[model samples]
Target: MKVLLYAEAKRLLSRSGIGIALKHQMEALKRVNVDFTLAIDDDYDLAHINTVGPGARFVANSCRSKNIPIIWHVHTTAEDIRNSFLLSNIYSKYAKFALRKIYSKADFLVFPTRYTMNIVRKYGVKVEGEVVSNGVDTQFFKKNEEKARQFRRKYGLTGPIVLCVALPFKRKGIHDFVDVAKRLSQCHFVWIGSKGLASLLPRDVREILRNPPSNVLFPGFMPQEELVGAYSAADVFFFPSYEENEGIVVLEALSCECPVLVRDIPVYEDWLQDGVNCLKGKTNTDFEKAIEKLISDKNFANELGKMARKVALERDLTIIGEKLKRIYEEVLEKHGKKDE
Candidate 1:
C-alpha cells in the first residue's frame, strides 16, 4: 500500500509547527515501514495532505477523480491562526471559509487533539475525523548532561532557567513571557524561536521582540539537536501560549525530563494535570506563582518531571507509528483496498 504524503508551502513553513508536525509524521511512517512517496504516483493507494492551498486543492481534486482516499491533517484553524502574524485576524474569516471547503473534500480529517477537532466542528467542518497526537522522538530529546552544559555555556547562562519554545507571536503569549521575565528578574528566561519574520508580526509584538528584558534571551531558531540540549538544561519549561492546537514543544520538554508550566488551555486538558505531570496557569500571577513553586520545590519539580517523562514515553513515535498504521489500514479497508 503506497501513500502520497504532501505538505503545501513546505519550504515557507519550515520553521513553523505545521511543518514540524509533517516532518515527524513522515519519520513515524518510515519507522512503521509504511511505503510512501513525496510525489504523487499513479499506483498510490492514498494521498495524505497537510495544508489547504492551491496545490493542496489540486491534489485533493486529482485524488477524488482517481477514487483515491484523501486524508487531511488539521494542524491549524482560523481561531488558532488569529493573532499569529500581521493582519492574521483580518484574514481569519476567509481562512475559515477556505478550511471548511477544503476539509469537505477529504475522505477523512486527522486532528492532533480533541480541542482542535472541537474548534473545526464549531467552525462548520462536517467531516469524518479522528484525534492523533504529533508524538515526539524520545531518543532525540532525551536528557544529556554534557549537552545541557554545553548549551548553558554557549549562552553563558546561570541560575535557574525558564524556557519557552514557540514562534514569535503575540498569541503565543510573547508579551506575557516578557512580563514574567520582568517579574522574575533572578531567573534566566530563554525564548527559542524566530525573529526573522518580524515583518509578518504585529507592530506591538515586533517592538517587544526588538526590546526584550535584560534577563530574557531570544536565541532564535536552534536546530533540533541544540534544542534538545536546551530542553535538558532548562530548569523549567514555561509556556504561556494563549492558544494552541497541541504544543509539540511540551512533549519535547517532557521527553527531556523538564518540568513544564503551561497556560490552562483546552488543548492540554486531556494530557496535562495541574499537579501530576505539569503545572497549568491561567493568569500572569498564576504563572508567576507556578514558576516560583517549581523553583522553590526541587523535589516536587523533579517528581513532576519524572511523571512528564512517563507521559512522553506513552506518546513516543514508536507508539504513534502503530496508531498511524491502524488509521491507514482502517481508511484503506473502508475504501475496499486490503491492507495486504
Candidate 2:
C-alpha cells in the first residue's frame, strides 16, 4: 500500500513541540516503510490530499476525488470571533463552504479531542470521526534524573520551577501566567513559545512581563531532546489556554512525569480527572492557588506526577499507534472489498 504525506505548512511546525510530534510520524512511517509510500505534497491527482500537516482538513477532499479514503484531520478550530479573522459573508460563504467540502468528501475524520470534534459538529459538518490522542515516545519521556538536575543547575534554579509552553496568543492567557509568576516570587517561571505578542505591552503590564531577579527564563525554540529534559526539570506544568481542543503539550508533559495544572475546561474532565491525574483550576485565583498547593506540598506534587506518568504510559505511542493502525486497516479493507 502507498500513503501520501501531504501538508501545506510543515515548516510552521519544525523544531517546536508540534515538530516533535511530526518527527514521531516520520519515524513510525520509517518502521512501516515497506508497507507504504509516503509522498509530501498538496497538488497531486484528485485523490491527493492537501494536508495542512497532521490534522488539517484541506487535503481531505483532494484525496476523496480519486476515490481515495481521506482522513479529515483538523488540528485547530481557529475561531477568533473576538478578533474576527473572517468578514460576514466570506466566512459563512466560501471559507466555511470550503471546509464543508473537506468534511463531506472524506471517508473518515480524525481529531485530537472531543472538543475539536464538537467544533466540526457545531459547524454542521456531518462526518465520521474519532479522537486519536497524540502519541509520545516512552523512551524519550523517561526520568532523566542526572540530566534534569544538570539543567536546573545550569539555569541556577534551586526552588520550584513552573513551565508553560505555548504560542503567546491572547487566548493562551499569557498575561495570567505572568500574573501567576509575579504572585509567587520564590519560584521560577519559564515560557517555551513565541508565536504571538511581539509588540511591547503597556507599562503596568511590563512590571509583570519583565524578566525578574533571575527567576524568569525565555529559552527560545529548543530541540526535541532538550525540551524533554526541560519538562523533566519542571516541578509543575501549566497549560493555561482559555480554549483548547485537548492540548497535545499536556500529553507530552504527562509522559515526562510532570504534574500538569490546567484551567478547568470541558475537555480536561473528558481525559483528565481533578486530583486523579491532575489538579484542575478554573479562575485565575484558582490557578494560582493550585500552583501554590502543588509547590508547597512536594509529596502531593510527586504523587500527582506519578499518576501523570501512568496516564502517559497508557496513552503512549504503543497504544495510540494501534488506534491509527486499526483505522488505516479498516480504510484499506473497505476499499479492497469494494474493488472485489
Candidate 3:
C-alpha cells in the first residue's frame, strides 16, 4: 500500500490521539457492500479500471462514468511535468496544458514538504494537502557520541568529524561540501553513502582524509543501523543540497541532539530557523561562514543544537499524526462512505 512506500503514513496514524481506519482498500470491500469499482493500476487487482498515472489524464473520462471520490498519494518527479521535455527528456517536457489539466482535476493531493508542494504548484496545482514530513523512529535515534568517535576512528579519522550521508548526486552539492573540507583542514571530514569518491577526489585531499593532514573518512553506504551510529558519533550533520523535499536526516540528526547545518532550502527553512533550530547557508561564502561560525562558537553551536532538538520534538509524529488521520477520514467521507 501507499502507506508502506515511505513507511510513515500508517505509523503516523497509529500514534496515540490519532484515529486511523481499521481497514483500507480491499479491507473496505469487506467492511461495506459495493457494486462497482473505479481503480488505478498501482495495484493490479482491479480488473476493470483506467491505468493512467496521476489519474488526472483520465479524470474527465472517469468523472463522466463514475461518481466516486478520488484520493491520490502524489510523488512528483521532473517526469510528471508536461514542460520537462522542453529541454530533451520526454518525461521532462511533454504537454504543458495536460500537466495543468491533471492538477486542476485532482480531488485531493498529498505532499511531504514545501519543496515538493512548490513543484506541483508550478503547474497551478491547487488543492487541500497535508505536509506529512518523512517520519523517523525517534526512540531509535539517540546520539552516541562515543560511538560516533569510535566509528570515526575505525574509518581512520582522528579529528573533529563532519558527516555527509548520501550519494554523489550533483544537486546534493558534493563539490561544495568538498570545498568546505578543503577550507577547514584542522578538523576531519567524512562522507558516507552508496559510492566512494576514492577515484573521483583529488589525491592530496583524499590522502589527508585517509591518512594524515587532519583525518577524513569515507565509509561508503553502509546499513542504516550503522549509519545511525555514525550519525551519533559526528559533531555535526552537514547537508548542502540544492533540491530536497525534506531532509529526513535533519530529523534524525536533531533527534540525536547533533548540530545541523544545511542549505537554506524551503523544506528546511519551513521547519528550521536560522541561528535557532539549525544553521543554514546558501553559497560557498555562506557555507564557509556557517562552518566557521559553528566550529568556533562551541557554546553557540550547542545552544543551536538543543534548539534543533526541541523543534524536532515539537512535531513528533505522536502529535502531528492526528492531522493526517483527520484528513484521511475527511477524504473517505467525501466519497459518501463516511459521515460528518
Candidates in order have lDDT scores of 0.90, 0.67, 0.57
**Best candidate, lDDT-wise?**
1
Rate residue 228 of model 3 by lDDT.
70
**Residue ranges of candidate 3 with Cα displaced over 4 Å:** 1-70, 77-106, 196-216
Rank list by TM-score: 1, 2, 3
Best by TM-score: 1
TM-score of model 2 vs. true structure: 0.83
Q: Native-vs-model 2 lDDT?
A: 0.67
Ranking by lDDT: 1, 2, 3
Q: What TM-score, to 2 decimals, does candidate 3 have?
A: 0.69
Winner by TM-score between candidate 2 and candidate 1? 1
Could you tell me the lDDT of residue 176 within candidate 2?
76
Give the per-residue lDDT of model 3 (tens digit) for 131-202.
665444455667766767667667766666787775544456666777787788876777775444445444
> Which one wins by lDDT: 2 or 3?
2
